[model samples]
Target: MAAADSEQIRRRYDRLAPWFDSLEGILEGLLFRRLRKKLWSQASGGHILEVGVGTGKNFAFYPDGARITGIDFSPKMLEQAQRKRQRKQIAVDLAQMDVQALDYADNSFDTVIASFVFCSVPKPRRGLKELYRVCKPGGQVLLLEHVLSSNRFMDFMMNLLNPLVVKTLGANINRETLKNVQACPFRNVYTDPASSDMIKLIRAIK
Candidate 1:
């Protein structure tokens, strides 16, 4: 991702921080439950690292025995994630950090997860490289991303409405997110095709 684009996304998320929890409260169960199921099934336990963990919406679904660290660019979003944890007693090491620059040491985590996140990251490829760099070589990078639909007509509509959409949701409507993943440093990947059209569930090793 370019520096300008990174700043754009960071600024957008910062703006959305106030309503971040409420917006997630609406889409929480339906959108994230599916994400949880697929990710856990592929990679279980072992010091998990989650990037772009907005409002900690996926916290409830992670395994009780796993060690987890979650980071997001928006501090308000992290506060919301902290609020959710006070009651559930889930132990998550949360921080406000940009995806393009991870703070951990090399081979820091056994599993790295991203869900509906990379689309808004300035350099999705750069972020993916950070993901790979931090993962223990055998560990997997699980992604549950929403991509631009393959349908040309839908693509056209998405292109036309992207500006309004990004302003409203802080999301990218026109990112060919799958292609971005395909270009990353991963192998032995698995993607659910039917699910891959709009939302792709992938498991790839570093």
Candidate 2:
């Protein structure tokens, strides 16, 4: 991603921070909440790194004994997450960091996770590689994402509307996330349908 594009996304998310949760409240109640619980249940715990931990929505589902570090590129988003962390008494270290260029050492974490995040990353493959790099050799990488549909008509519609969605929401609704994951070095990569064919729960072994 270019510096300008990245900055634009950061600014957009910062502006959306305050109303982020409310904006997706209906979707959260109807679908995302259940998917999040399923995603967290697969966590190996120990040292965990959660990328794009927007507003800390996944904080409540974190398993006991997990030492979690959450990062996001937007400071305002992190601020919202911090407030949630405090209100819920969740033990997590929040930081402002970009997933495309993580600041951690190689093999720094036992598990790496993300939820509905890859579509917004300007360079999704680079971010996945960073996730692969920071995770231990035998560690787990779990993700919850919405991807381009297999249906040709729906795929065409998503591609057609993707630009408008990106312009307004800073997220692409038509990402080929499963293919991107396959391009990474992670082993045992697989995915399961989450809410629908468009949403997926991805699992990979690093």
What lDDT tens digits, residue by residue, belong to model 1 across residues 109-128? 99999888877876778888
Off by over 4 Å in 2: 193-195
Off by over 4 Å in 1: 1-4, 24-27, 193-196
Model 2 C-alpha RMSD vs. true structure (Å) is 1.0
Give the Cα error of residue 21 in candidate 2, in Å.
0.3
Q: Which candidate should be chosen as best, given TM-score against the real structure?
A: 2
**Could you tell me the TM-score of candidate 1?**
0.90
